[model samples]
Target: MIEAIEIPTAAGTFDALACGAPGGREVLLLHGFPQSALEWEFQLTALGGGGCHVVAPDQRGYSPGVRPEPVADYRIEELIGDVAAIADALGWQRFDLVGHDWGAYVGWAAAAAMPARIRTLTAVSLPHPAAFLRAMTEDEDQAQRSQYFTLLRKPRVAERVLLADSGAGLRKIFDWKIAEDRIDDYVRRLTEPEALTAALNWYRAMHLSGPTGPVSVPTLYVWSTEDTTVGSTAAMATERYVTGPYRFEMLEEVSHWIPEQAPEELTGHLMRHLLAHRT
Candidate 1:
């Protein structure tokens, strides 16, 4: 059975779900905006069955225990620090890292900021920040695609629009992409005013910061062609930001919800990436 646990951080106590046996290699799973650690349910089971312990956190502002008020509390540095605090709380010197969407953004930054604390990185959906920024500014397609972020940056209106009609607005965000049950979970979370604001703060706190420099750890980037939020330009440019061994896997016709819609394939890519570096 998966167990929910709390880890203390400089900010507050963060909630996480853990599964599998102790004393095994640890995999730190981080969930993205508008989602919780529940997003990693499939991966936790798969990795646990493979004799790897997994810890997936809801992250700050998302977890009720660690929700901070000010938008500045959700900056990249603080987000990355939360991941580090999770690792420290578990007494892990290093662990395999996997994250999706905004979680992937934090994972990318964390790995880059402290390469020694990460064994391997599996960044799902989102690419490195530098690549994304370049694509956002230079690629008109990306700029157009990201226009929704401008709306999300707005304070209370974005929250009301998302939570209106029992979160029908949030449901429309997923449309026909994510599964119904998963969409329900996302809507439920977004209904909470603080939760939705915290998630959006990740965007509001965006700055001119680049990727923490080229990552030295072995990494795997999973990009989906059908992802509405990311484009081919940024996806393909991810390789340029990694200084160490890297593998890029492209999922054809898959949406941003790859972890849920294609868990087996995602797990396969993650297993391959982690196992390849075992020896």
Candidate 2:
């Protein structure tokens, strides 16, 4: 069963969804921009049923109480700290970490920053930061795909542009991948000015420093061919940054919304990775 809960840490209070028994294996899932712990509902169900304790929090900016105004508060280190803080609050001495989209960027950093505390890592729809940064500089396709960053980094402009037209632009980003019913709620939440601004602050504060190093935890990296946000250059280059056991799964026709759009396959990979790496 999934339970809505709140976790209080030194940083702030976070709204979260948790599943499985208190003593079950630990797993922490992180959602990316414009999304919340809600994105991991499917994963929580499957993994919790499989005897793993999973918790997905409305990360730093998404959780209203945790939202801070300064862009510096949204830096990559703060993001990584949030992950550890959440885990610490959960009483999880060690846990399997899974992340999607921008969440994956944080996962990579967490794995590198606190290698001993992470048993395994699963990153979806994004590659390692070093690989992605390199691809952005040398790969035209990736550079083109990332051009949208220029706009998202703007303080108030992105909030205006994305929330415009009743979130038509934002809703369109989901395309036909996310369930129609789920789209409205997700879009509506982001339509709130403070929420949208906090979400975009992630892009504005991104410096990718800690994530640029080698990740030493057992890791699984999932990439979808149709993911417009990430490119083949970075996906293929991700292996170079992992010093521990690594597995890369390429979903042939999947889009960037892997958890919602490809839950079964994603669950399968996650289960195998988790079961194999149980410490």
Candidate 3:
């Protein structure tokens, strides 16, 4: 059974959903933009069923308690610290890490900043920061793909457009395969007062200035063939940044919503990669 609880960190407290053996080999799951710990419902159930301890937190601005007003509060450094502090609070000196979308970006930073503490990393849907930066500079396609980041950074405009007609604009971004009820749940969370903006600050205050070097820990980077947000250029370029064991799994015909739309397949990939690196 999934337990809903408050997790205290140095930054503040986060509402998290946890399952599995509390003392089993720990795994921390971080969700991405416009999503929450609820998005990992499947992974939490699957991994927890497999005798693993799992905690998925509604991160930073996503959690009402941890929301800070200033956009600067969402910068990469603070984001990294939140993940580290959350792990520390969980009494895990080191634990397996998994993240999707913006959470994947934070995972890359967390692994780089606290390599000794991140036993292994499974970064889904986003590539390493440096590779992404390089692609944005050199690849026209990737730059075009990333244009949405600019739109999302705008203040009142984004809120209105995304919330218009009960989040029709926001709903258009996802594939039709995602259940309508699931979309409704995500939309409701984003429409909460101050929630969407705080989440957007992650894109606005985004700077590639943190521990964004080559990762030295065992890692798995998963990308999708049909992901319109992250192009193949950066996805393939991700190999150069990992100094230790690395595995790249590409899901053909999969969209950006990998975990939600393709849960079973994604879980298999995560379990194989993480189990291989277990201490």
TM-score of every model? 0.96, 0.98, 0.97
RMSD of 3: 1.1
User: On residues 166-263, what C-alpha lDDT tens digit does candidate 3 reach at each position?
Assistant: 89988987757588888889889988999998988898887534548889999999999999999999999999999989999999999999999899
lDDT of 1 by residue, 199-234 (tens): 888878776334456777999999999899899999
Alpha carbon lDDT of residue 35, candidate 1? 80
Taken over the whole model, the C-alpha lDDT of each candidate is: 0.87, 0.90, 0.91
Worst ten-residue run, lDDT, model 2?
Answer: 204-213
Instruction: Write candidate 2's Cα lDDT for 141-222 as tens digits.
Output: 9999999999998877887788889888788888778887788888887876588888888888876334458999999999
Candidate order by lDDT, decreasing, is 3, 2, 1
User: Which parts of model 2 have CA positions greater than 4 angstroms off?
Assistant: 208-211
Candidate RMSDs in order: 1.3, 1.1, 1.1
- Kindly report which residue pairs in candidate 2 clash with one another: none
Q: Give candidate 3's whole-model lDDT.
A: 0.91
